[model samples]
Target: MTEPTDLTPSGRLPVTIEEEMRSSYLAYAMSVIVSRALPDVRDGLKPVHRRILYAMRESGFTADKPYRKSARAVGDVMGKYHPHGDSSIYDAMVRMAQHWSMRVKLIDGQGNFGSVDGDSPAAMRYTEARLAKASSFLLDDIERDTVDFQPNYDESENEPKVLPAVFPNLLVNGAAGIAVGMATNIPTHNPGEVIDATLAMIANPAIELDELMQIIPGPDFPTGGIIMGRSGIRRAYETGRGSIPVRARAEIEEIRKDRQAIIITEIPYQVNKATLQEKIADLVRSKEIEGISDIRDESDRSGMRVVIELKRDATPDVVLNQLYRFTQLQTSFSANMLALDDGKPRTMGLKDILEAFLRFREEVILRRARFDLNKARDRGHLLVGLVLAVANIDEVIALIRAAPDAATARESLMAREWDASEVVPLLELIHDEGNVIIDGKVRLTEAQARGILELRLQRLTGLEREKIQGELGEVAQKIGELLAIIESRPRRMEVMREELLAARAEVATPRVTEISDALGDQTDESLIEPGQMVVTITRDGFIKRTPLEVFRSQNRG
Candidate 1:
C-alpha cells in the first residue's frame, strides 16, 4: 500500500488554552453585541424585529390587506431570515403590536396582545397581525435598491441589512436590550417632536442641545404620566445616560359625603396596575401605611382608573405621597442610549444619533435615485428602437416577410445599418449612449431588435405610435430629474426634507407624558403612614412589622 501522505499539514499551532478561551469568549460576546441585542442606529431594530417586518411585507400582510394568522408571519421569518426559536420571534412581534410598549405601534394586532397589568399575550396561533400604515414610511422604496442586502442563513434568499427608514425611528419608538456586558435603555419621544428636531438639524447642523431640547422637551411614554423634572432629560440628552423619575397621574376626590379616595388615571410606563394595587393592600395590612380602607381597579375600555379609598381622618396628600414612595406608582427609567453604529456598539447622545440618521438617509436617497435613473434610461433606449422601427415600418415589414424564421429576421435587423436622421434627436433627448450615430446611420442592438420584433400589429396604428412617443417623452423627463437629484447635494437634502415631512404627517401625534418642574422630595420617614404598629425581632437579627390588631386584648389567655 502506498504510504499515506500527511493529510493534516502542520497540525495544530499549539495555542495556549488561556488564549483560546479568551479569543472564543470575545467572539461570542461580539456576536451577541452586534447581531443579537443592540438596535441599528438607522432603523432602530434588532435582527429579529427587522426579519419579521420584512417577511410580513414580502407576504403581502400590509395595512390595506386583511390580517393573517400571526403564526404564518413568525414561521416565514424563522424559516427565511432569522433562524431562532418561534417563541422569541413571536415575543418580538407581539411587542411591536403592543401600544403601551412601543410609542408608535408598528404592527396592527387583531387579538389579545397582553396588557399593562402584566397579563400575557395570546399564543401566536390564536392572534392575527399585519403591518401598520406608518410602517410604509420605513419599508417604502426598499425594492428600489435603497439599502444593502446579504444572503440569508441558508443562502436561499437575500435580506436587507437595514431598512430604508425615512424618519428617526430609534428616537420615536425607543429601544431596550441586554447584550454580553452592555445594555440599552433608550426612552421614546414624541413623533412630531422627533421629526421637528430632525428638520431643524437639517436646516442647521450646528444647532445646540438646549435649542433641541426646546423642540423636544422630553420622553413621551405611551402610558401617559408626569415626569418629575427636566434635569434628567437634559443630562440624558447631553451625556446619553441619566435617570428620569416618572410618577403616576393621581387625583384625590371625595367619593362620598366625607370619604376621600385617590383616583389613578395613568401609571408609570411599564408598571403593572394589578401589582401596584396588591402592594398597597399589603402595606395597609402590615400597618406600614395607615390611610387606605379599600382598593379596587375600575379600569375599562374607556381608560384606566384605580381607586384607593382613604380612612376618615387620613390626609389625602400625605397618603398619596406615601404610596408614591413605596409602590411602583413612581419609578425611574434609566437611560443607557447604547446602540449599534456601523456594526459596533456605541453610546450616542441626541445630536450624534440625528447626524448619523441624516447621513444614512442621504445615502438611501442617492442609491434609489441611481436605481430609478438606470431603469428610465433602459426604457428610453427601448423606445428609441421602437421610434426607429416605426420610422422605417415598410422596410422592416418587407425584411421580416423575406426571412424564414424570427431568429434570422432578428439577425438581419441587427446587421443592416438604418438611417438615424429621424431617431437621433430622440436619442439625444434621453441621453442614450447605447447606439452611436456614424455618418447618420446606426445598427440595432440585440435588445432593441427584440423590442422591435415583439411589437404588436396594433402598435403600428397612428394612435398607438403616438402613445409610445408620449411615454418615451415622459421617461426622458424622469431621467433628467433623477440625474439632477443625483448630481446635486443640496437638491438631495431638499428631497430628504420633503420625504421627512410626508412621513411626519403619518407618524406625528400629540404628546402623552407631561414634564413637570416639581422636584421629587419625599423622605423615608414620610413613606410610612402615621399609625400604630408592632415590630418583631428574631434571634437571627431578622426584623418585621405587623399590624397592632395581630394580638387581641385578653385577660391572661
Candidate 2:
C-alpha cells in the first residue's frame, strides 16, 4: 500500500517514454493525414468535406430543395460525423460554396460566403445553403451501395468513407491542405478537358502524358488570369510538383487627354485584391515603384477593373511592369499534388491520379451492379412463390381454410409439394438456386410459404395472376442486364464514360485563365516599338514629343 507506481497502473507493464511518445506522435500524424488534410483520390474531398456533403444529402438539402439555415447543416455535421469545431466545419462548407474557390462549386449558398478580397464569410446564422447540382455526381450512387461506409467517431452513426464520385472531382475542383509533416496543393482543371482526358485514357490506357496534356493544357483558375509558360505546367503534371507563374490580365488604355491607365481585369488565383492594392500603394509611397499618379478600384458586378492611373508623362508600360514585378498583380501557384490513395499519402502525377480514379470507379460500378442484381433476385424469388400459389389455388385455399392459425397454414404450405414447371424458367432466368426441384415438385421455403399465407383475396384473380408473370419477366430481364454489366469490363467502362460525359455537360465552362507561351518576366524595353521621336522643349519649360516624320528635310529653308 505504501509503494507508489511509476504513473503506471498496478499490474500493468511499464513502457519507455520514448516508445510511447513515438507511437503517440505517429498516431497523431496519421489522424491528421487521413481525417483532416488530404482529400480522397476517389472523391477529391477530405473527411470534413465528405461528412458535410453526406449530412446535407441525408437531411434532404439537395440541389432542387430549398435552402436551409447554414447553422443547421453545420450543427448536424459537427454532432454526427465530424466532431470538429463549428467554425472550422462552417468554413469548409463556405469554401465549397464559393464560386471563386471551387472550380465547380458543390454548395449553393444564398448569402455572402466571402469575397476575392480575402474577406471573411458572415456567421453561419446569416448564411443559407443547399447542395449544388454538380454535387449530385459525387453522391448519386451512395445510397445504391456504390461505396463503403464506416461508423462515426462515436460509433453512433454511419458515414461513407469515400463518395462514389462519378465525375473526376480531384482534377475538376482540386484541393489544398497541410498535415503534420506534409501538404498538398492540387490545381483545378477544366471539367470538359478532364472528362475528355479520362475518356481518352479509357480508350487507350497506353496514351502518353503528352497526349493527355494536349487535352488538359494546365490549371484553369476560377478568376480569369494568364498562366505564363508551359514549362511549369509540364513539370507539375509529370512530377506532381512545380511552380506555375500567373499574372493579372491588364490593358493599357488612354483614359483622358494625355493620361494613360492600366486597367486590371483579373487577378491571380488566391490573391487578395485588397491586400494586393495595399501592397502596390505601399510600394508607391516607399518610392520602390514610381510613375503612379493615382490608384482606384472601379470593379463592379460586370467584372473586375482596378484602374492604375498614370501621370501625364508617366510611362504606362514601365509602371505596369513594376507592378507585376513587385506586387500580387503577379504570383506563382506552387502546386504539390499530394493526396491519399488507399489510406496512404502519395504524390500523384496526372496519369497516376486518373488511373486511380478509373480503378475506383470500376469497383463502384461493379459493387452497384451486384447490389442491384441481388435485389432483383430477391424480388423474382417472391414472385415465383406467388406464381406457385396462384397455380395451385384450390389446394392452397383448402389448406389455409383447415389450419387453426396463420403459422400452421405456413407450415402446411411448406409441407406440401407443388408443380415446378411454371417457375422453372423464371428461376433459371434469375439464376436463383434457393428453389430446388425434386421429383418434378418444389417445397416452399419459409419466405415463400409466408408469401403464400399473406396473399390478398383479390390477388387470386386471373388478371392478378397474369400481372405476376409480367412483373417477373421484367425483373428477370433487369437481372440479366445487371449480370451482363458486372461481367463485361468493356460495358462497365462505357457506363463510366457516359456518366462522366453527362457530368461534364452540366459543369463544364469556358477556361478563365489564359495560357501564354511568353515567359513570366518581361521588360518594358521589349514592349516598346522601334521608332524615332523628336523631343522639343519650349522656353517656358514645357516638353513634348514629335514624330521624326513630322519635320521634312529643310536644307533650303
- Top TM-score: which candidate number? 1
Q: Please give, for residues 365-431, the per-residue lDDT of candidate 2 as tens digits.
A: 9999999998998888999999999988999999999999999999999999988998888789879
Off by over 4 Å in 1: 1-11, 524-557
Clashes of each: 0, 0
Q: Which stretches of candidate 2 lie over 4 Å from their true place?
A: 1-12, 523-557
lDDT of 1: 0.92
In order, candidate lDDTs are 0.92, 0.91
Q: 1-557, model 1: which lDDT tens digit per residue?
A: 89866455677456778999999999999999988999999999999999999999999999999999999999999999999899999999999999989999999999999998889999999999999998888899999999999999999999999999999999999999999999999999999999999999989999999999999999999999999988998889988999999999999999999999999999988888888889999999998888789999999999999999999999898899988888988999998999889998999999999999999999999999999999999999999999999999999998899999999999999998999998888988998999988998999999999999999999999999999999999999999999989999888999999999999888899999999999666886665556677788999999987767654442227
| Ten contiguous residues minimizing lDDT sum, candidate 1 | 547-556
Q: In candidate 2, residue 385 scores what lDDT?
A: 95
| The best candidate in terms of lDDT | 1
